[model samples]
Each structure stands twice: as structure tokens, then as C-alpha cells.
Target: MKEVYITKISKFLPNRPISNDEMEDKLGIINGKASKGRRIVLRNNQIKTRYYALDDDGNVTHNNAQLAKEAIEQLFDENFTSSDIDLLSCGTSSPDQILPSHAAMVHGFLKCDNVEINSPSGACCSGMNALKFGFLSVKSGQTNNAIASGSERISSWMKGHIFENEIKHLQALEDNPILAFNKDFLRWMLSDGAGAFLLENEPNGETPLRIEWMEGYSYAHELEACMYAGGDKLENGFLKPWSEYKTSDWSEKSLFAIKQDVKLLSANILKKGVDSLKRALTKHDLKPSEIDYYLPHISSHFFKDKLYQEMVDNGVEIPWENWFMNLSKVGNVGSASIFLMLEELAHSGKLKKGQKILLSVPESSRFSYAYALLTVC
Candidate 1:
């Protein structure tokens, strides 16, 4: 099979910096009197800011098409134009898309008539999934160059009319819709931002990084673990839904051959993923000692420790004390985390040639995605 190369990566984190401290202060004020039952522990600022496409009122943005345009511009700045792109994919949940795919809007706005474009929807993992899909398409001799990127204005997920009850319960949120429930999830644990990459069949010129390989699989049962509004009706191959009769505890759900508990889940999933990667390594004749760095799609600091323990439990060895770090400074950016890590590695000169890299995606309550990508030789 032919190989696909990742030519370059660009990230667009907004100028607005919302640190954990900032969020905590805002939350304390936002939920002051009524959020006694809602609990969240914030990072002592171990996490930092994330970008946003704000409205004129300095609030979270609702114009997704504009954000999409800005993301594309930021990704290819000082480099590409409409003429250079052949395939464009926009993986997003929010876009100025009422009638057409957001990618089509971008294509029309850029006035690039020759390129093929698509908009993929899968929520947080959408951008990463789009990238691997494009990689396979290229490797299968379908396209030569592709642009894969995504943006999330999670701010829009809020609805004023829907939260009237919650606001009524809380005195601090009399003026605004305070996200008390998600505060625990957001704490220093996550942030909001966007990033993109320009993938090519071959990299030349000033391209900072080159692709190696991208592989994926579906754990259907696992997919049924984490889900939302349209979770049960999942018909597309994109999502892993939470089981129809899912209960409160993570363990009660039948993993079948899989065990329960967060630790066991991490160990088991990591073991399976590493086994697949081991097969890939055997096919390529590589080893763990050969991998200089590891980039994991982390969702929580707790899982970070659990993952490390699982690596030891599964007997996978490596020197990753510094390798498996999270972007705690910026929070978790969903599917954008891995790509953002790739951008960071390349720009910081941490992603060197002939290096084997391992990236394990976090548990989405459904499935955990893992991959083994090698740096250009």
C-alpha cells in the first residue's frame, strides 16, 4: 500500500485566556448561592487558556461558519491557498451549517472550484477521525493532498430557554446560564480550542512533519458506553453509543470479555491497542525501546496516572516520564488533542525523524482509540 504523509499542522487558540483560576473565580460567582450540591475541583492553574470565536458582546460565539473560515485561514497562513488544496474536510459540531456541509461553505468562500470537500460530524473525535479517513483515502490512491481541520464553539451548546429551571434554582445565575454541571468536567481538566493540519501524499519544502501510519477500529460494546441526545439511534459508523439500558455505575455495564472498573478498562483497552500496535511493529520490525516519545489523548489527570500503571501492568516498557504529558495548560480540546500534540511536538522539535510514536485516545465512555504513527525516516 502507498503511504500518506502529514505535511504540516497549525493551531488557532484564541487570544482570550481562561485559566482554571479564572474559571474557578467565575464559577464561584456564577454559582455562589445555589450550587451547593454541584461539586468540581479546579486545577491550581495547571491548565491555561483556549481560543474562541467570540461575538461582539464578548460572549461565546455562535457564528460557526466564520469560525470555520478562521480555522482554515489560521491553519494555512503564510503558506497555502485555494489552489494548493485538493481535498478539504471540516470536522465540527458547530458551523454556519443549516443547509450544506460546513466544508462546502468553506470551499465556496475560498472560491476554490477544483477541490473536493466534506463535512464530517462526530463531535469531539470528529477532527481526528476525519484526518485518518483522509489518510486512508490518500493511501488508497484516491487523493494526493488533503486539508483536515475542525473548530468547536462549545459555548453554543447552551440554550437560554432550556436552562430556565436551573437558573431559577441558582441565585448567582439570575443574569446568565451558569454551567454548574459541566464545571466538574471543565475544572483544570479541560479547555476549548481548535487546530488543523494540511496532509499531503508527500512532504517537501518547509513542511515540518511527515506522516507515517494511521489505523483505527470499533469496539461496538464500548461505543455504547458514552452517548448523548441521539445516542440510541446511532446508525452511522462514526459514533459509539452508550448502551440502551446503561445503568449508573461504569462496572455494571457488561464489557463481556472485558472487565470493569476504570483501572481495568484502561489496562484492557491499552493492552488490546498495544497488541495491535505490536503486530504493526512486527510487520515493520520495530520495538518499544525504539519509540522516543508518546502522545496520549488525555481527558483527566486521574486517567493519566491510570494509563501509566496499565502500561506497566501490560508489560509495555518505555521511558515516558516526560513523554505522556497532557496539555494541562490548555485543557482538553476533544478530538483536537492528538493533532494539537502533534503540532506541539513538531514545533518544539520533539518529533524527530525515524521515531516511533504512540498515541492513545482517552475513554469517551464509549470507545478508546489508539494509534501508532512513525515520524518520517
Candidate 2:
């Protein structure tokens, strides 16, 4: 097998950064009432600024495909062009349309040569899945080069108008006037962005990140869904998909709104992550002490310390100094998060040759997790 190297990393954040105070103005208030959970959620997430594809008037300036296209474009140069791409893979949780795969839409916008394309669907792990696909393609000599991307245009989904119907329906039933914490909290926790990586058999750029190993695990067989959308959770924890619901109930129930089972997430997220990390470490015969940098995709500041304690308890602790995170600045871009974090670190001019970087991504959707080890060369 040929060695695969990440040649380049790029990211595209739509519009200007919207500060915390400006979020409500951009997303609007559901039923003309401020969200009681917004401030608390923001406080926990610690995201001070985030981007949106929407303009000042709440008009969409760029869709998910456009964002992915822009990020991929940054990977091209005088030596490499879109025509040189052998494969294109994209991953996202918020797609512009459901019928055409996200990669297909991105390819249409790219207008590149006829090439193989792949779209991996999931929550946060989707982006890492795309990267793993590209890595394997290049490593196995199936493709000379591959472009993988992760993006999200979730601001539009979180807009107040999308939940107005649900709020009215609930009010008419004499239930809570506002959305449940599960649905409403995410409005402030997520933002819009896209990130892409160029993978090739040969190294390029000043400091190439060689793919050492990648592994992923899903506990869905033993765990129920912790985060979901496009459906409702039944009493027994089974998800009723959008196809099973009537069209009228879609809006009335806010079936499309992203929701999370916070209690389940908090209880199992770190535990499962540590369990998966332990297995990966054992499989690769690696030690946490050997890692020079650890990039973890955490949705909130609330998990930073907890994750550390969990790792310590599991006897796989990587000290705080070895950690690198940008969540407080970029917000949570879901599937695009790990890509964005890696993009920043890759361009930060801080890496040294032979240093090892560990990437960790956990998806609360169904308690899935992905981990990758890279060596700076």
C-alpha cells in the first residue's frame, strides 16, 4: 500500500462572524419571545462568534454545496487543478437537498472533470468518515488523489420561522410555550462552515501530514440515538422517520429540527469515547504520552474538563498542554468541525517534523466515534 499524505487543508466560513449578541437578531425569536435557553446554552458552549450563510435580511447567500465548492477550490493551484482530481467525497448533516447526494451537488458546483464521487452521511463523524475514505483510496492505489470535504449550512434550519408552527401547535395544546431544551438549545450551539482536505500518494506543501492510522466505532447496537432530526422519538426510544409522518405533522411537530437527548449524551459520550480510544490505542500499539497534539471535536466547553478526567480515569491521559481546540471561536459546525480545527492547526505554523497529531471526533447521533493518528513530515 502507498502512503497517503494530506497535501492541503482549507476552510470556508460564510459571511462575517456573527457575535453572540447578534445571533438572536439573525435567527429571529420564535413567536416573538426570546429563547430562555439561548444564554445558558451559549454560556456552556462558549462559542463567542460564528458564521452564517444568510445575509443581513435573512436571505441565504450560499448553500451547503457552494460552501463545499469554495473550500475545495482553495486546494487547487498552478500545479493542481480540478481536472486533476480523481475522486471527490463530501460529508454533511445539513444538506441542501435530500434526493441528490451532497457530493453530487458539490460536483455540480465544482464543474470538474468526470470523476468518482462519494457521499458519507451521518452526524459529526461524517467528516472523519469522508477523510478515511479518501485516505484508503489513495493508500490502496485506487486513486492518485482525492478531495474530501465536510460542510454544514445549519443556520437556515435553526431560524425561528422553522419552529413557529411547532410552537403554535404546542401553545394550542396548552403545553410549554417554548420549544423543549433539546430542540431549542442547539440553535445557539451550531453554525455554518465548510472544510476540505486534499489527499495524495505523495506529499506536498511545507509540512505534509501523513496518515498513520484511522479507526471508527459505532455503539448503536447497544445504545439508542442520542441526537436526531427529520423524525420523532417514540416512547420506547425508537425513531419514527420522516417518511412515516404526514406532511402536515412535519411542521407541526418540527420533525426536521435537530434535537438531542442531552442526558444520554452527557452520560455516555465521554465514556464511549474513552472506550473507543483505548481500543484504538491497543490496536495501534500507541501511548498517549507519545502524542504531541490532540485535536478533539467537542461541542461545548462543558466537556473539556470532563473529557480530561475521563481520560485520566481510563489511564490514557494526554495532558492539557498537548490539546488544541478552536471550538470557542468557530462554534460547532457539526460534520465540518474536525476539518475546520485541523485546517487552523495545519496553517498555524506551529507543527514540527516527526510530531504526532491525534484527531478525535465523537458523534452523539448514535454514540459513534472516529479517531485518526497523523505524523507531521
Candidate 3:
């Protein structure tokens, strides 16, 4: 197999850091029923600060494709240009437009006429799928140069905070405000960012990472309705388009609306994630003991212990210190998370040449998982 390597990695986050306190205030979460809901999310999730592409009044500042284009531009040097890229795979959950596809828009924005574009839309692990496409294309000699990128504009979701009247109604229905308004919590947890990787078939010199093996898995059938958007799963196991939902409930319908089964996610994410990684290691004939670093794209700190225990149960035995994360610093950038984590780790000056590293991404949406093994070179 032709070896593929990532020559450079870049990340773009909109605006400055916005603290949780600021978000709570700006979203109008005062001493109302939503206040307890906001407090629960802030106290449970370890995110102190996150980046948003929003103005002072909470209006969208940049669209999804623009954020992705900026990140890809940062990857280019004097020797690289849009024309040098033969393939562009864009992964995004928040697309600026649906008809043109985010990747195609990016290709046009970059003014590239000959690049093949593919947008792996949906779910958080969609970004890893985009990277896998680029890696496979280069490794197979189908394309010499490819860029895999993940970008999200989830701050747009924050603009549509649940109305005060609705919050009052939900609070009346349940004693726990968090449980009553679970979807509202996602707005606070997810953030806006873009991360990109430039892949080449041949390594000109020492690079950040050389792709060894990449594998992705999905158990959507088994964990159906665990996480979803665009539609809601009914009690009968059929997804009903939100447009068809009656009762004047605009609260459950929006371009950025997302529904999640928290019970299923908290129960299955770690076990399935660990299993997927173990399978990848076995397929590549790799040993967990040899991995120098483990980079994980996790949305919350609550899952850290669960994943650690899962890894221990699976016999990987990697210490907590070996796993690097940027969730607290960047929040959950959705599809862009893996690339952002990788970028942070590469620039942290901790990795050494010839060291082996593992990158893992687990998505609640569709219950998908991906693992990549790389060597610092």
C-alpha cells in the first residue's frame, strides 16, 4: 500500500472565548425556569469557555462553508494552492445550504475547477469519514493530494433559544428542568470551529503524522434514534419530518434542531467506542501498549471515566494522562472535533518522531465510531 501522510493540520475558531457565564446571560437565562436548566448543563459539563460565531446580540457572524474555507486556507503554504488539491472531502453538521453541498461551495470559494468534492453530511463522526476518504484516495494513488476538513456553525442554534413561555410550560411538566428541556442543553455544549488536514501520498520530510490504518464503524441499526436531526423518531419507530408535526410546537423544529436519547448515549458510547478501537487495533496488528498518545474527540468530561473504564476492561490500560483532549478549551466542535484535537496535540510539542498515536471519534448520532492509527514522523 502506498503510504499516506498528513503534511499539515490547521484549525479556525470564530471570535474570542465566550465563557459559560456569558452564554447564560446573553441567552436570557436569568432567574427563570431555564436558569436551573442552564445551571445544570454548566455545572455538569466541564466546559468553562467556548468559541461562537455570534455577535454581541447573538446573531450569526459566519456561515459553515466560510469557516471551513478559512481553515483550509490556513493549511496552504507558498508551495500549495487550491489547484494542488485533487480531492476535497468536507464533513459538516451545519451546512450553509443544502442544494450546492458544503464541499462544492468550498471548492467554488477556493476557485478550484478540477477538484472532486464530497461532503459527508450528518453526525459528528462524519468528519472522520471525510478524513478516511482523503486518506484512502491518496493511499490508493487515486489522488496525490487531498484535503479532509470538518467545520460546524452550531452557534447559529443558540440564536433560537427556547421561548420563555415554553420554558415555563416545560418546567411545570417536570420537576427537573434539565430533563424537561434536554435539547436546549445542546446549544450550550456544542460550539463553532473548523479543522482541516492536508494529505499527500509522499512525505517530503518529517511530518506531523503518517497514516498507518484507518477504520470506522456504525451500529445505527442497534442504536436507532440515539441521536438525530432534521426529523424526530416517533414512538412507533418511524421518523416523522418535523414539518408534519402539528400542535404549533415550533420548539422541536429548526434547521439546527437535534434530538438525542441520553440514556442510550451514556450507556452505549463508551462500550461501543472501546470495542471499535480494539477492533481497529486488532485488524492493524497493533498493540495498545505501543501507543504513545491517544487523542479522543469527546463532547463532555462526563464520559472520561466511562471511557477509561471501558479501555481498562478491554485491556488497553492506557493511563488517563496519555489521553489528550481539548474539549474544555474548545468545547464540542461537532464534526470538527477530531481534527481540532489532533491540531492541538501536534502543536503542543509533546509528540516525538517515531511515536505511535491513536485517534478515536465516537458520535451519538447514528451511534458511529472511527479509529485511526498514525505515527509521528
| RMSD to the hidden true structure, all candidates | 7.4, 0.7, 2.8
* Candidate with best lDDT: 2
Candidate 3 on 311-358: residue-level lDDT in tens? 898887687777888888889899999999999888888888899888
lDDT of each: 0.56, 0.94, 0.80
Clashes of each: 11, 0, 0
RMSD of 3: 2.8
Worst 10 residues of 3 by lDDT: 247-256
Which residue pairs clash in candidate 3?
A: none
In the range 347-377, model 1's lDDT, one tens digit per residue, is 7754555666665554443554546465644
Candidate 1 residue-wise lDDT at 300: 53
Please tell me which predicted candidate would have the highest TM-score against the true structure: 2
Alpha-carbon error at 172 in model 3, in Å?
Answer: 14
- lDDT preference between candidates 2 and 3, better one: 2
